[model samples]
Target: MESDSAYRSRVRSWLDDNLSGRFAHLRGLGGPGREHEAFGERIEWERHLAAAGFTCVGWPPEHGGQGATLQQQVIFYEEYARAGAPATVSHMGQELLGPTLIEFGTPAQQKRFLPGIKNVTELWCQGYSEPGAGSDLASVATTAVRDGDEWVITGQKVWTSLAHVADWCFVIARTEPGSKRHRGLSYLLVPMKQPGVEVRPIKQLTGTSEFNEVFFDGARTAADCIVGEPGEGWRVAMGTLAFERGIATLGKQIGFRRELDAVIGEAKATGAYDDAAVRSAIARACVRLDVMRAYALRSLGNADAGTAAASKLLWSNWHRDLGDLAMMVRGASGLTVGEGYDLDDWQRLYLFTRADTIYGGSNEVQRNVIAERVLQLPREVRQ
Candidate 1:
């Protein structure tokens, strides 16, 4: 086993050597609301990372990954973020779906999908959120019915991140009629680029469309594409959620740290550091971020639902608050955009973080999960 320092050194060295030349300009180009920046170039850069065996480092060696230990995976992500490597275009596949497939997918399914993810040959999007189902995934209304060897799907998935560019979608749809809430759902791997599917971009406050509304009039996939037994998808879907909030979060925190540092730099540049309140806010952001780091490191690999929910609450509020501070630092100047409505990093950061508490899981929902599941309090009433 490589020592942690050695692993970190190796990752840093690799990033230093590779993230130059044509890719030199791409550092810190894509993330959050800025997904429109140099996107095609970022895809090329990701393929370069993939070709060098740096992608999907956590999966076992059998699954086309380096089979890196959890600590090493953290080191890689930290180094990657620290290096300002562009935000990956294949996160849905490399981070969420790949691990889910490894855990619950059939051997055949793993064989069919893992390589594409590792190599960045195929991009994926999550089809779990719907017009009505966002965080309440159990209320998914999209339906899939078996037709001979194929499953015909019909429904709409809204706020689907990267759906316009995805070649496949891991969907949670109502597979059994009369099924309610969490029961009778199936996790199906459906392909995009078919006549049955239409992707319409939903404009965001950032003036970008990183997510989309996908209409599945009659999309079809092989019946064998289901991840688990029919009507047992709730379990498999939860497994994917577990993966969704895993070791990769530490890397995300590293990105948060970078964003925070940028905000601090902006404060100094704009003379906001002169204000006692602004200085205190900045200090509080730094201290809270450190606390978040400590909590994440402590909770690594634990997967307690309460801990996960708490972590989400901490980071989401912190990021949104950072956005608020960014605008505060700029004062009235942050309100205006360039002639083309182009926003600088600070403005973009401020606008984008407004949704931080809303997406993934809302702050309200996280509090509810903590109240009922963590505190063992009475559950909130629902209609």
Candidate 2:
């Protein structure tokens, strides 16, 4: 096995060489209002990463990966974020579904799905949150009933990101109707190209349809499509959520901090730095960014040691604060979009940050986990 520093050096060198020329144009491919072309570019970029054996760095070599260590995978993400590489189009598949499959999927299941996912040949969307089940995913009412060899699925999922473009959906449905909220659920990998599955864009306040509401009426999948054992979907879903809260969010912290620095530079150029109050706010933002970075590193250390959870709460809180500070620094200009004073990114980010608190197991619930699991505090009683 190679040393961690050696692996980092190797990945960094590969990115510097392969991503220096035309690849540089791939940066920011999926920013606001450019989803279609950006999606196509991202697919091409994933092909490049797959060809270089960097698409799923930590996955086993037999599964279209280089069989790198977890640290090596982290190095790839950190270096790519620094290089400002285009965002992956298969984020839902690679980050959440792929890991869940690795944990609970059968050998056949892995062999069938891993390659397409790693190569971004079949994009995926998550079907967890519904109109009624937003943060309370356990309340998902989507039903999947056995009908011979096929399971008929019906219901609607709201706030499904990228469903309109996805070729597959990792759907969590209530398989046993009479069971309690968290039980009787089964996760199914449903193909999105089939009939009876409809995706309607849900425009955000930023005027982007990055998310959608998906309706499934008599949608069907083979029984083999179930992930893990029946009624174990909740556990599998939790594992995916843990990955989302742990590694996925950590990968973006450094990039967000870098953006914060750019915001500071913009403020200085605009003479906002001369104001004592603005200077104080920027200084406070810098401190928070540093804290977020430290928490991210600490989370990585815990992941290496196989003990990671407390960092989720820290990250959730700090991310909200960082966005608030950015909006404050941008001031009145933050309200507008599209280029004027670089406010487009700031405004879009501000709107998107509103969802940050809600997704990946809401910050309120994360705090409860931290209090009970990390701090061993008494739980609050509900009247």
TM-score of each: 0.98, 0.90
Worst window of 10 by summed lDDT in candidate 2: 301-310
Best model number under lDDT: 1
CA RMSD, predictions in order? 1.0, 3.0
Q: What does candidate 1's lDDT look like per residue over 1-383, in tens digits? A: 88999989998998999999999999988887878889899999999998888999999988989889889988998899889899999999998999999989999999999999999999999998887988888889999999999999999999888898899999999999999988999999999989899999999988899989999999999999999999988898878777777888888888999888888888898788899999999999999999998998998887777888898899989999999999999999999999888888888888889998877878898899999998999988889
Candidate 2 has which clashing residue pairs, if any? none
Q: Model 2: how far is 183 from its true place, Å?
A: 1.2
Per-candidate clashes, comma-separated = 0, 0
142, model 2: CA deviation in Å?
0.8
Stretches of candidate 2 above 4 Å error? 31-37, 301-310, 336-343, 375-383
Residue 343 lDDT, candidate 2, scale 0-100: 35
Question: Best candidate, TM-score-wise?
Answer: 1
